[model samples]
Target: MASEESLEESKKKVYRKEQALKRTAESLEDDEEIELPRKRYYRQRAHSNPFSDHELIYPAKPEDMKWSMLYGGSNEAPTVADVGCGFGGLLVSLSPALPKERILGIEIRVQVTQYVLDRIHALRKQNQGKEVDYTNIACLRGNAMKFLPNFFGKGQLKKVFFCFPDPHFKLRKHKARIISPTLLSEYAYCLRPGGIVYTITDVKDLHDWMRSHLEAHPLFERLSSEEEESDECVKIMTTATEEGKKVARNGGSKYIACFRRTENPK
Candidate 1:
């Protein structure tokens, strides 16, 4: 009886392993469909450590990056980056507003980034003949925290948006929150003097944390409430992103903190 029971348990374990493998296969199949063109063209890399695979997404130098390929051979480089752009809502809304300025959205998730790419492709096709071409905006899969400087030249960016960023609420995970001292230094390096860093979140603790860090950073100075209110981009950022819309629907309060890159560290 003991030997029979042992055999039965072993069989159950094997069955469970088979079920897990089946689920994993199904997930991979779904991912393949979603990541079609990218899966075919680009080599896949681990999402956790973006810098580990240096050749995956970024060019060696910002100047070496082919903006033309993405923006229809336009010589002008992107002056704005929407970090962690999910579903590309903010980029879509900002495209019409800043008709001339090139904008790039960097997202980490494979399927979400692919969805944004497809969304942009559809929008561009829809408005092919219109005066306002969305060729100014593009999306790419990137880990912004690790590879920000890899993409933008020093003082190349005029605006950086951190709209509804992931709030790493745990005390231990705060370093991953994206607005750290080290990351702020990188942000300051990429942003032109007097350029803006716009941040907003529905999470109050996260908002406070971001504000305090920016305030403490020598290179950044907090924007006055009036100045923030006057900026058109702020308004769009507040209402444009998917997170922003969800916050609005739920009547949740959003905390905004805008900072300017100073000419010299204070």
Candidate 2:
């Protein structure tokens, strides 16, 4: 029963965090320009170590999630997920671009997640009653590597973005990289056949590593150059991520590799 008690305590902590988040969003005034969250105030280490949970909240399963608290009006489950969504650049960019689809940004850092939450609330209030009010986009605090399948049902997501992910340079730490053989299976299971997986990174070694793994996965097929160029999501991702912007400012190279989730083998 100790294990069960621990689970209950974790759930309570998560519930309290949710309530605090609600209060923060509710406290925002419907002003001409809702005050934007300051990055300096939401200070967090550049690289997050996912093993550190810090007592955050997540659903036991997808069904138990309270998505309405994360979004304003949308009742639909998120169709797109941006993993390691630092500062939520892609999440904000994709909001108006795909107003019909619910986009969820999953980040592990508590302060970063709070900043994204505040930023989203500000954006919604700023664009209130506009054509695209950003009700379809939201951010959540969770470890995507460990809990993605718990939050996304089978064949639930149509698009998944891994933009400028941590390279995990040390050979011993390669297993910590997000696109490992085992994680790819979970990704494939969550995405429907023909769904797209978009990955980009400035680090060449990490690029090659992710590409090789996805290629080896039986359920994934690499997209063609023409297809990558033509995809709107790919285009947005190239410039929408915070790390992508930093790379551009420093004149670094970015490698992109996209794959299609194919049907499960008979």
Candidate 3:
């Protein structure tokens, strides 16, 4: 019973959807080279996220990023990584303020990753080491969930940020959610003793979920409410995530949680 115009519109919509799927498939094909080491390679094959043309950069491997070797120090500079670092907001915004020597912004989207790279390049040119150095900031376009081990060793990172990640709200889709017991282990593994994980979400349920998992994890201890507030990096996280801005514009409340990685129980 639909009108002729409505039927035509539906046909066009179907065509567009098909084309999008085709493009995504092509992007995946283009990014097959960014896989991790042999043991981790098979896992990444199951989930491939691609970046666009401008998003292309020299791929990083764990061996290529040996922290101690790079700095000639037994302990590397306490590093910070922004997972799902869309357009470099968190890394670029907070780099000037952080005391750490290295900040990594990892984004899955090629176009967005490239955008962040351009922004960093521009900022570097203007600042010229006036306020901060670009040598410490780097962007990598790869699947964060899988490639995390590609750049860090056990307990190598000091802080991690998961802001405004895709809130796969459906019950069946919970596994796809960024914060899970399994993923927490990965986060904990990458974090140094006393390192911290910072997460913010507009969805109350997701917020509670992150808090519960992090709190229950034996490797982590919940940060006090006062500690979360007073923490400079936590404050930066509130403004650095894309979703945080969206939440603010809609007059929604943001739920934040922080957990400090602890030594393994003996």
Best by lDDT: 2
Model 1, residue 24: C-alpha shift (Å): 30
Candidate lDDT values, in order? 0.82, 0.87, 0.70
List the candidates' TM-scores in order: 0.79, 0.88, 0.73
Q: Is 2 or 3 the stronger prediction by TM-score? A: 2
Candidate number with the higher TM-score (1 or 3): 1
Structure candidate 1, residue pairs in collision: none
Q: Model 1 reaches what TM-score against the true structure?
A: 0.79
lDDT for model 3, please: 0.70
lDDT of each residue in 1-266, candidate 3, tens digit only? 56986776676556545434544564566432221112111112222233224343332756565444322345354388888887666886777787455788877765456556555655554555475755467676766666677677788888898887777778987777778889889888889999999998888999988889888888999989999999988888897766677778889998889999999878
* Candidate 3 error regions (>4 Å): 1-61, 66-78
lDDT of 1 by residue, 153-221 (tens): 999999999998878778977777878899999999999999999999999999999999999998999
Model 1: how far is 138 from its true place, Å?
A: 0.5
lDDT of 2: 0.87
Ten consecutive residues with minimal summed lDDT in candidate 1? 34-43
C-alpha RMSD values across all candidates: 9.5, 7.8, 11.1
